[model samples]
Every structure is written in C-alpha cells, then in structure tokens.
Target: MNRIEKKLQSLQEKKEKAFITYITAGLPDMDHCAKLIRAQEEAGLDILELGIPFSDPAADGPVIQDASYRSILKGTNLRKCFELVDGVRKDGCELPIVFMMYYNTVLHYGLEAFAEKCAKVGVDGLIIPDLPLEEQQPLKDALAKQNATILIQLVAPVSGKRIPEILKDAKGFVYCVSSMGVTGQGASFHKEVISYLKSVKEQAQIPVMMGFGIRTAADVAPMKDIIDGAIVGSHFINLMEENQYDLDVAKAYIQTFKTELK
Candidate 1:
C-alpha cells in the first residue's frame, strides 16, 4: 500500500484521528520550510501536505495566496519542493509527505517526468485541486507505477447520484471540502456541511478527510468521530505569516489540533 493508505490503516487499527498539517513549501525560504516540516513531525502530525506554490491557486484563499506569492518570490518550484521532501527524508523524518499542487505546474513539468521525480524522491501522494476525476487516470497510472496515491477531492453538496462515481475514482483518502467556497478558516462549521461529510463517509470505502475552513481545534473536534482526518492549511499559513519562520511557534500552534483528536 502507498503511504496514505498505510497511514489510514494504521490510524484505523489504533482508533486514532489523523492530524494532517499543511505548509506552503518555500514560503519564507526552503530552509525554513524544511525546519517547519521537521517541527510538524515532532509535533505529532500524521501526514504533511506540502503546498507547491503557484501563481494562480484557484482553490486557495487570500492567506494561502499570499503564502504562494511569498514562496514564489523565494524561488520555490516543483523541483525545489521535491528537494524539500528529500531534505526531510535525509534527516530521517518518516511522516508521509503529500504534494499539494496545481494542474498547470504538473503540465509544465511534464506529467510523466514529474511523477517519476516524485517517486524517485519518495513522495507519498498528491493533491491536485484542479485535476478532475476524468483527467486523473493517466496521472494516476504514472504514479501507480511507483506506488504513489493520487488523492481526490469530493466537494460539498454534490448530488446523491454523483457520490458513487466520485468515490469510485477516489484513492488514498477522499478530501471533503467543508465549505462550498474557496479555502479559508471560518468561525463556524456548518451543520449541513457535517451532514454532507457523513454522507460521503457512508458512501466512500476509503478513509474520508475534511479540509477547507478548518482553522482551530474546535473546528476539528466535532468531525473527529465521523472523519478519519482533518487538513488545516490557510490557518497554518496565517501562523507562518505572523511568526515569520519561527518553527517553534508554528509547532505550538499545530499542537492545538492534536488536543482535538480522539
């Protein structure tokens, strides 16, 4: 099994909720990004979603947009992101790394070549927001050759008829968007969103993870029973922006989520 599926199996067997932390690779700098990742692993993160900064991140909100811009200014690209993962591996960090990127970058890098590099560098999985299910087959095939999982997103309020099709195409764990809009942390988690997550969980055979608008521990606590994992991005980027590469503070902030997990 790929790292994602293995991690999910491990978590399920232990009856634990997974804490997935998201950080924009090369935000302040690649060096600092590496440090933050190490810190996250130390902070007990189950999975790390390393955001590959892009110029137009349609799925991201202002917080992640600013982070992407900052990372690009620091010369972060797909290759550098891989190097960051390599750095982590060299340091003996075993926490699964998932590359969260855009479709344009993958196309620019040449899909096959990119997948090859990811496999070579020991990447566990990928999260491409813009790549639809229909277009994922080729990429999935390439990654499968190296045993890498292609994580698919399942949007909220999707039609009941579409759930089966979406779950059929999903791998690793299904990412359920808690909100209908762009990614950002909100004050409250919608009841309807929770219901939708439950429905998706019911239909999906694989583990289901909730992302989008998950900022604080309270936002994650309620969903722990129903979802396998919680992914926090915008909020963590906001922490990085506020702290300016202080990994200790970032790690301490991430520790709050650990408290919420059952």
Candidate 2:
C-alpha cells in the first residue's frame, strides 16, 4: 500500500477520521508555501491537497481563484510545484501529498512525462477536478504504467446515478464534493448533503472524503460519520491570507480542526 492507503488504514485502526488540508503551491510565495507543506504533517494533517495554480480555474471560488492568481504572478508553475515536493521529501516530510489541478497542466506537461515526474518527486496521487470521467482512461493508463500516482476521482451531489461508475476504478480516495458549486465556505451541511455522502460511502471501496464549503469543525460534525474525512481549502487559504502568511498561525489553525476530529 502507498502512503494514502497506509494513512487511511492507520486512521481506521485508531477509530479516527482523516483530516485533510489544502493549500495553493507558491501561495504568498514559494518559500512560505514550502514551510506550510513541511509544517502540515506535524500540524496533524493526514493528507495534503496541494493545488497547482492555473490561469483558468473554473472549479475554484473567489478565494482560491485570487490565491492562484497571486501564485502565478509569483512564478508558480507545474515544474515549480514538482520541485517544491522534491524539496520537502528531501527535508523529511512523509505525509501523503496529492496534487489538485486542472487537466491542462498535466496535458501540457505530457501525460507520461508528468507521471514520471510525480514518481520522482514522491507525489502520492492526482486530483484533476476539471477532467471528465469519460476521458480519464488515457491519463489513468499513463499513471498506472508508472505505478507511482493514482488518479483520485471527484463526485458531486448531482452525480446521482453516476456514483458507481465514477468509483469503479477509484484509487486513493473519492473526493465527494459536498455541494454543486465551486470550492468555497458558505454552503451548509444539510441533510441532503449527508444523505448523498452516505450513498457515496456505500458505493466506494476506498475512503470517501467530503470537500467544498466545509470551513469549521461544526461543518464537519454532521457528516463525520458518513465520510472517512473532510477537506478544507478556501478556509485554509483565507486563514493564511488573514494572518499575513505566518507559519505558526497556519499550523495552529490546522490543529483546531484536527482536535475537533479527535
């Protein structure tokens, strides 16, 4: 098993759910981003969803969009992200790191070439939000060849009847989008959302993690039993921005969520 599988198994043994955090690569700056990545595992995060900035991120809300824009202006790219991961590994970071990016980045980087690079840099998985399930085969096959990274699938509430099909070849875990919109923190954890997650959990052979609109511990409480974990992106990016990108503040903020999960 890989880092992700081992992590989920470990959490299951401890009767604890996973707590995953998301941060944009080169956000604020490359140095700060690197520090945050290294600090995350020690902060009590089970997995790190590191986003690569894209010029057009349709799935991201205003907060992530702005953060991605700034990272781009600071010269963050796919290659830079790979370098960042490699640096952290050499520095002794053992947390599972998954890249959440658009398909264009991987395509431009070349499928086979990208898979090889991820293996070299120690990326455990890939989450391409914009890539449709119908078109995932080629990329999936490429990643399979390298046997380095697995393609993590996303399923929204509207995915309705397509849940099984989406989870068919799923590896790592299934990213269950809590709502129908882009990534943000306003949406509530209503009964409907919980029901959808339950359905997803039933169909998924791997862990099912809920993301989008989950900001606080209260948001995670309602669906805690239905999901294997919770994913927070916009809220974390907002916290870093609000605190002037202070590493301690970011680390402490993540601890609060981890405590709640425990």
Off by over 4 Å in 1: 187-191
Summing lDDT over every window of 10 consecutive residues in candidate 1, give the lowest-scoring window.
151-160
- Provide the lDDT at 108 for model 1: 93
What are the per-residue Cα lDDT tens digits for candidate 2 across 1-262?
7789899999989988898989999977888788888878888889999999999999999999998999899999999999999999999999999999999999999999999999999999999988999999999888888887989999988899999999998898999988777889575543489789889999999999989988877787877778889899998888888888888887787898888877
By TM-score, how accurate is candidate 2? 0.97
Superposition error at 253 for model 2 (Å): 1.6
Clash pairs, model 1 backbone: none
**Candidate 1, residue 208: lDDT:** 87
The most accurate candidate by lDDT is 2
Which 10-residue span in candidate 2 carries the lowest summed lDDT? Answer: 185-194
Q: Whole-model Cα lDDT per candidate?
A: 0.81, 0.89
